[model samples]
Target: MAPPLDPEVLRAALVTRGSGWTEVEHHDSIGSTNARATRLGRPWVVVVADHQSAGRGRLARRWDAPPGRSVAVSATVPVPASGAGWLPLLTGLAVTEAVEATTSLAAVLKWPNDVLLPSDDDRKVSGILCEVVTARAGPLVVIGAGINVSQSRAQLPVETATSLLLAGARVTESTGTDLVVAYLQRLADRYAALVEAPVTGGALAGPTGLSGLAAEYRTRCSTLGRRVRMTRAETNGAIDVVGVAVDIDAEGRLVIDGPGGPTAWAAGDVVHVRLDG
Candidate 1:
């Protein structure tokens, strides 16, 4: 088992980035970090929790994990001056890169803001939640991440879930915390660059922007080239869609092709299918 998180140790690991961070013993939920950070209105300010009582995911699913066995952190970043709304996508790319760098695991990104494992044999290792908060200064975006680090099977809520330690991936407390800090730092750097660039009036301009990001995401995504079913709360039935897993458009909408032809699903729950009807 990894050692407990030391404030000094975590702070030291994060000092290189020059960002303010706050650690808490326990939180009602890490999902609330975004809201808390927004009220603080400080860029690069982070809120971390040892345990989340009411953590949440996409579609309001509870994201509870055993205390001290996972990492839950949230950071707020100022919106880029370029007016690019796709900053969340950029954040996802940064996380994917960081996870790959630290664990050497092939991290795949699901549409919008989910980071999944490359193999079906494994469960989701990480999840991202992005929320935009309007303040007197302007729009501040809070990005929250939850990662499974050192939990066992009995500690998890579902059998379909997994953790880094359970997967035989070695990650000490220092290394795991450092990994989260690194990803946040990288995300801040990318956002800073985007803000300084001239307004191109598109999703992400330049040769090395969102378009390039999409390309990288496509390669890591296992959902591509497979058949899947999407269910939405409003819909009475599931929609069968073939996973072309192509590039996401500027607004971060996924493009999929079904037997009926081509369709763009704006929002829904995505499930990969093993067999087709």
Candidate 2:
């Protein structure tokens, strides 16, 4: 078991920062930090948990983190509904940077959501989920990030997942706390940029081109420039679309060229297809 988070230390490190993080709350355990933040409905607040019992991933997939083994954080930020879709991608950048900074490991995004450490067979080390909520002030996006910090390989919930420690992070008891702080700082900076950039009516979606968020996402995303097999969203079928993922369009959809032509997918399970060239 990892050392429990000291709320005082976290508060001390973050409360005075200029990130607009209004409140930082730590929990010994929680069902889901996202649920908590959504219920709170306060913008610029961060809710963190040492253990998340009912954490979820995209498509209602369960994300299991045993007590003290991972860092689960949900941060609330208000954004225009039109720009809400970019939050998850922005959060992915935050997680990638934080994990790389904290663990000294090369982290890349597996487009749409999962954060992967390439050294660990491209296994996912973190995951992001964004939920749009209606708030009195406006629209709020609860950005949830679950990062595996100290879990050993045997302790992982799946073979395709990895932790910072397993991926060569020199972790101490403060590893979880360190990751949370770094992640939130990165998120706050990126979120501010997302909010400040001008939104224009163009081929791209959201306030991306002006902000350069989409361009940055493309650089960190490993899904681009690779052949992929995507699970069909409509039928829940496997490999309905097999193509080369070429780009992320203005609206943040995955652009792929298949047997027919270039198509943009809004959401689906994408598997990188390794081929012998």
Candidate 3:
């Protein structure tokens, strides 16, 4: 098991840097940090758990890693209703950066939310999910992420997944804390940019929502310029849509070119196939 987080140390680390964190809590075990953060209803509050008994991923898939071997956490952020759609993309970027910093690895994103370490042959190092909750005060976006940290070779849950330690991350207590702090800082900065975007006239849904945010996402996205197989949102039987992922449009949809034409998908399971030569 990993050492428990030291709140005082975390607080001092941020304060000494002329930065500060909002309410934060750490638990040795929990059902899900996202569930806890959502239930708490406190903006900027963060909850982290060493182990989750019932963590979930996109489409209700299970997400779990051994205690102290990963980062399973969630945070609540205040955002305008119009900016809710941007949270997932922004969080993906934040997690990717944090993993890269902690691991000293080139981390890339597989769109719609997986973080990969190239040293692990593009194996997944983290996953993210963003949710919006309505409250009388306004809208709150709850973001959850799980990052594999120090799992032994035999402990990985899936063949496609990898831990930071396995991918050459300096997996110490301080390294994990740094990873968490880095992610929170990045999220706070990106969220500010997203909120400052013009919400009037549906501007929040366009590329104008955040200056250069789309381009940045594109640069980190491994799906772009690659052939992909996507599970269709609407299925007639089990048919899927296979195409080349070419872009992330103004509204953050993955634009693909198929046998017919370019179609922007708002939601689906995307599997990276190969680069389109």
Highest lDDT, which number?
2
Candidate 2 residue lDDT tens string, 28-83? 99999999999888898889988999999887789997898888899888874355
Q: Model 3 reaches what TM-score against the true structure?
A: 0.90
Model 2 poorest 10 in a row by lDDT: 202-211
Q: Give the top-scoring candidate (TM-score).
A: 2
User: Residues 1-277, candidate 1, lDDT per residue (tens digit)?
Assistant: 4444455655665655345343322243354655566677766677776666666676767778776787777787666655355566667777777777777576766665567665436477777777777877677777877777788888877777777767666686575666776787677766766665444664455656655555665666666666667778676555545555554665566677767766777677777676744
User: Which residue ranges in model 3 land beyond 4 Å of their true spot?
Assistant: 13-21, 199-201, 204-209, 233-237, 275-277
Tally clashes: model 1. 0
- Which 10 successive residues of model 3 have the least lDDT summed? 12-21
Per-prediction TM-score to the true structure, in the order listed: 0.83, 0.93, 0.90
Would you list the C-alpha lDDT of every candidate in the order shown? Answer: 0.66, 0.83, 0.79
Backbone clash pairs for candidate 2 read 204-250, 205-250, 205-251
